[model samples]
Target: MEDSVFSLIRTKYNTLSPTQKNVADYILSNSEKVILLSIGELAQFCDTSETTVIRFLRKLKYDSYQVFRVKIAQELSGETTDSIYEEIGTDDDIADIKRKVIQLTISSINDLNNLLDEKQLAFFTEAIVSGGKAIFIGVGSSGIIAADAYHKFLRLGIDASFSSDSHIMSIACAHARKQDLVVAFSHSGESRDILESVELAKEGGAKIAAITSYPNSSLSKSSDIVLLSSSRETKYRSDAMISRIIQLVIIDTLYVSTVLKLGSEGIKRLHKSRLAVAKKKT
Candidate 1:
C-alpha cells in the first residue's frame, strides 16, 4: 500500500481523457512537489479547475486530493536519501556529494524496509526454493542485477540462470514450465524485450516475480509477486543509480532470508560452497 498511489497513476494514466492527461502528467512529473502543495495550488499549476484535480484523484480510485497526497508523501518519503535533487552550482564542494551519497544509502535501506512486503518476499523465496528452475531476465544495468541474482540463487543450489541477450532469453523462457520461476527486472517496467520474455514465460506456465521501481509497471502486472524500489529523478531522466542499489538490497535480503529458512542444511551448503570456491581459486 505504501506504493499503491504510483501503481494507480500508472494503471490509470493511459485511460484518462485529454483533460485528465494534463493533471496526470503534472502529477507524475512533479510528484514530490505536488505532495508538498495544496490542492488549489496543484490545480493552478496544472492549469485546471479545482474540480478536475479532485476528479483525477477519483479516477485513479483515490477518495480525494488529501488521500492521494498522503500516499504520494509515503512514496517519496521512501526514496533513497541521496536522491534529493540539487542543482549543480559554482559553490558546490565534494562534501556535498559525499553527504548526499550517505543519505541516499540510508534512504534506500529505509525504503527497502518500507516498500518491501515481507510476506510477499518470503513467498517469492519459497517459490524459488521449491522451483524446478529459475530464469532471470533484464537489460543493461538491470541485466547485471538479474545475473547477480541468478548467481546468488545458483550458489544456494537453486537452478538459476540469466540472459542479457533478448533472443536467447526468449528462447530459454519458452522452455520453462509451471514449476519454474522467472524473475524479471526493469526499472520502468516498460522494457520491450523483458516484457516479451515475460509474456512467453507466462504462456509456458512459469510462475513470475518482478523487481521494479514502479509497482504498476507492465512487468509488475504480469508477475505473481512484485518488489518495489525508490530512486531520485532529474527533469529529463530518472537515473537507476539509487534504484538499482535499492533493488540489490532487496536481493540481499531475499538471499539471507532464504538461508535462514533453510536452517542447518542451508548453512552446511553455504560452507561447502565457500570451500569449493576457495579450492577452485587455488
Candidate 2:
C-alpha cells in the first residue's frame, strides 16, 4: 500500500518539535500549494528555515523533499478541498459551533480511511469471532466505548465482558486464557491502569488488541494488534472527546464484520436478542 502523508502527519503530530509542528501545520492547511512550492519557498512561507523543513520531512520518514511532495500529490490527486478541523472561539454563535463540530466529526471519520490498517482490523474481527472469549477495558470516556463494544458483542451472542473499574479489569486480565481476546481502548494509549491491565493479560497468554490514537504509545507496544484512530484537538474540543466518536465507529465496523463472518448463526442471535429486549417494552 502507498504511504498516506496526512495520516503520517497526524500519527506523528504529538511527537514533532515546535518548529516541525509549524511546518506540519502549514502543509496540512495548504496542501495544494505545498505540493507546488519549492523547499526554500515552503520554508519561507512557514517562517522557518529550510533546515527545519528538511527535518520535518525526515520525521515523516521521507528521504527527500521530492518524495514527500510526490506522496502528498498522490494523496491529494483525488481529494476535495474540505476543512479538516476548525477552532471554536468564544465569539462564535451556536450555529457556527454546530457547523464546525459537524465538519470536524465528518473529516475525522473520513481520515480513518487512511489511518486504519485493513489487515489489523481483520485480525481483530477474527480474534473476537473465533477466540471464544473477549474482554473489553477502558477508563473515563474510553470506558464508554468499551461498554458499547461489549453490548454489541453480547447482542451478537459473543461471550464478552467489560469493566471501567481498574480492580475488576486487573482481575479479568489475570483470568484471561490463551483463547481469550482482550480489547483495550485508550485514546492517548498511555493510561497507566490500561497499560498495567494489558501487561497482566499478556502474562496470562491472551491476544491483546488496542484501539488508540497514538501508534507509539505503550499500550500499542504491548498489543498483538493495534487499530489507529484519527483526531485533532482544539481549545474547546480535546482529542479524547473527538476520538470517542471515532472509536465507536470502529466498534460498529467490527460488529458488522463479525456478523457477516458468523453468517446465519449470527443473524439468529441478533434476532433473538432483539426479541428478548422487546418483551420488556411496555
Candidate 3:
C-alpha cells in the first residue's frame, strides 16, 4: 500500500524550507479542504505562490498537484490511524505508560516504512557487501548504535571498526581508503564530531552513508547514501528513545540483506561465528 500523505508530510517536515513548511502546515491542518482546492488556491491560502506549492510537492516527490490531492483524498476516505504525538502525563500509571510507549513505537516504525526509500537501502547494503572495510561513528546515544552495528558486522565476519571518541574516530577516518564505507548515525544529523570524521573520510575517498532522522542535515548532504528514520519527541521522551529502536531495525535489515546477497558463503560464516561463540559458553 502507498504511504499516507499525512505520514509523509510529518516524516519530511524537518527537511522542509520555511516557505515549504508553510505549505505543509496548511495541508496537514486542512487535509480535507486541501483535496478540494486547486493548487493556485492552496498557494493563496498558504500566502505563497504557485511555484512555491510546486516546489513543496516536488520535495514530497508528487508528480503533480492533482496527484498530491488525490492521495490526500484517498487517505481521507480510508480508515486512518491517529498517530499524533501524545505527551505522557505525570499522573499516568504503569499500564498507561506501557500502552503509550508501545503505541508510539509501533507508529514510529510504520512511519519508517513510509519514509524509507528501498533503492537507497539496497545501495547501502551493496556498499557494505563490496567495501573493503566498514567504519561506524557516532557520539552519545548514537555512539551506542554505532557499537551495536559494529558488533553485528563483526559477527558476519566483515572488517569493521567503531569508536565513540571523537579523536579516535578522526584518526580512524584519516586512514579510510576508497574501498571503505563509513556509516555515521545521528538523530539530529548535526553532530560536529560525526561531521568532522565524515569530512576526513571524504578526503580519503571513502564513501559515507548516514542513518539519520533529518534528511536535510549536514551529514545527509555529505553522505553518498542516506537512510532516514522517523519518530516524534515529546516532553518526557527524547528523540533517542524511539529513534534508537528504528536505527537498530535499520541496521538489522541491512545485516540480513547483506547475508542474503552473500548466499551460502554468508550462511557458512555466520554458522562458524555462532559455533565459536558457543565454545566460550559453559
Candidate 4:
C-alpha cells in the first residue's frame, strides 16, 4: 500500500482529473499523516470531496475506507502482529515482515515496468554502450549503487570508475573528456555532491545519467538521461532500503542491455575480464 499506491498516482498523475490529482498530490506530499486522517479529513485537506478520495482508493484496489485504513495502520506499525504465522503478542510477526518486503519488491517491479520508457531506455543504452568511459557518483547508501554500477560497466568491458567521496568525484570529473559519461545516484535527486559532479562532467563535455526518485529534481534536469525508481516509506524503516534495491535492479537491466547492444565483442571482453580478474585470485 505504501508505494504501490504512490507509484500508481505518479504514473497516472498527468492523466488524472483535477480533483483526483489534488488528492494524489496531497497524499504523496503528506504521506506521514495518511493513517491519521479520516476519509473526510483527507478530502478536506486535499480540497476534494470524499467521492474523489474513494475513487482514488478504489483505483489502488482497496475495497473501502476501512480496509485501506487498516492496511495503512499495519504499514505504519511495521506490519501486522496478529497473524497465524506470527509469534503471539509480538510487536511484529515474522510473516508480516516477509510479506511487506515481498510486496515492496513486487511494487518496485511493477513501477519499473509501467514507468520505463522504451525509447529513452534505448537511447541510454546506446550512450552507455558507446561511451569512452563512465564515472559513477553517489553518497551514503547511494554509494553502494555507484560501486555496483561501476562493477556492472566493468563486467560489460566498459572502463568505469566510482567515487563515494565528493572531493574525489570532483577531481575525476575535472579530467573527464568527451565520450565519457557520468552517472549520478540520489534517492531524492537533491544530493549536492552528486549535482556538483554532474555539473563538472557537463563542463568537461561528458554526457550524464541520473538514477533518482524525483524525475523533476535538479539531478534529473541536469543529466542527459534519467532513470526513475520508487522509494517506499514505512514507519520503522527508512526509504533507502527500497530505493537501493530498485536502483540495483535498474542497474542490472542496463548492464544486460549494454552487453546485448555490444554483441559478441562485448561477450568476449566480459569473459576475458572475468578470467583475467580470476587469475589474480588464484
lDDT to native, each model: 0.78, 0.87, 0.87, 0.77
In terms of TM-score, the best-performing candidate is 2
Q: After TM-score superposition, what is the CA distance of residue 86 in candidate 1 from its true location, in Å?
A: 4.4
Candidate 1 root-mean-square deviation in Å: 5.4
TM-score of 2: 0.87
Looking at model 2, residue 45 earns an lDDT score of: 97
* Candidate 4 all-Cα RMSD: 7.4
lDDT of 2 at 225: 94
- What count of clashes does model 1 give? 1
lDDT of 3 by residue, 100-135 (tens): 888778778888877788999899888888948999
- Residue-level lDDT for 36 in candidate 4: 85
Candidate 2 structure quality by residue, lDDT tens digits, 183-257: 999999999999999999889899999999988889888999999888786779888877899999999988998
* Least well predicted 10-residue stretch by lDDT in candidate 3: 78-87
> Which residue runs does candidate 3 get wrong by more than 4 Å?
18-78, 82-85, 89-93
In Å, residue 265's CA in model 1 sits off its true spot by 1.7
Task: Give lDDT for model 3.
Answer: 0.87
For model 3, state the Cα shift of residue 256 in Å. 0.8
- List model 1 lDDT by residue over 1-282, tens digit each: 333465455445445667887887687668788988998999899898889887888887677778778877876787733224343345657896676566545645565545678888988879888847989899999999998898887788777888999999999899999999999999889999999999999998999999988766788889898887765443322447777888888889899998888888778878877888897774
